[model samples]
Target: MESYGDLLNNNKVIFDDRNYGFWKSRMKSIIGGIDRLAWKTVLEKWEEPTIKDEKAIHCSVGRKQFELIQGCETAKEAWDILQIQYEGTSKVQSSRKDMLASRFENLRMEEHESISDFSSKISTLAQEAVTLGENI
Candidate 1:
């Protein structure tokens, strides 16, 4: 089995702006796996980690992503910044959810589309909705 240090080094979760939901889940898993306190550092505004959770976050992201969280003092602050940047505010999220719901309601398989292709489209839409914190 890989050591914890090995896991930390090998399983860094890099965030690309396009898939914030997937990246957020992966990063949470990685940090939580490292130590509960480290994950708590991201969730709790005031909790500090013995290990620098911010460093882990910094090392996992690229230069552009780094700029988003560089000014953060706490790990939770950094996490929130990225979350807001990618997920937008709650109002924006609600609007996005409405748009996605409309798309899902109107989705129809094209005449030339295969069943598999149509199913894939549905799956993608469903996944995106789930990423946005929708129950669908």
Candidate 2:
């Protein structure tokens, strides 16, 4: 839910080219929970950098990704298009899974770190995995 969380904090979502899961989950929570009439307004709030009304998406997306959503009438449509474009195929998903698994395997709590810091580190990684479709 990082994207939605960023939006809630009045910050633009920071997306790397690869982090589709994090963005998609947050989008689902927002879009799925709301009624159809509320879709455009909510999409406007998160994607537009300005508070003024306009028929556009002005968020922090890449140029190609931005092009895919041009003239989209609803945030839901834009989100769907983005999912199709960036979610990748099964092989890509497998590769990402393997990479994350290796990182988690090498993780260790540093001796000098406070208990809170250690817990937060663990929690953040765990949250990331969960967002990426890990059962844990």
lDDT of each: 0.79, 0.58
Residue 59's C-alpha lDDT in candidate 1? 71
Cα lDDT tens digits, model 1, 101-129, are 99999999999999999999998888889
- Residue 77 accuracy (lDDT) in model 2: 67
Worst 10 residues of 2 by lDDT: 49-58
Looking at model 2, residue 127 earns an lDDT score of 68
Off by over 4 Å in 1: 1-4, 50-53
Error of 1 at 43 (Å): 1.4
Per-residue lDDT tens digits for candidate 2, residues 1-136, read: 3444344445334344676666555554444444454455554554543544322233645566677777775565666567556655667666767877887888788989988998887776776677657744
* Model 1 alpha-carbon miss at residue 54, Å: 2.2
TM-score of 1: 0.81
Which residue pairs in model 1 clash with each other? none
Clashing pairs in 2: none
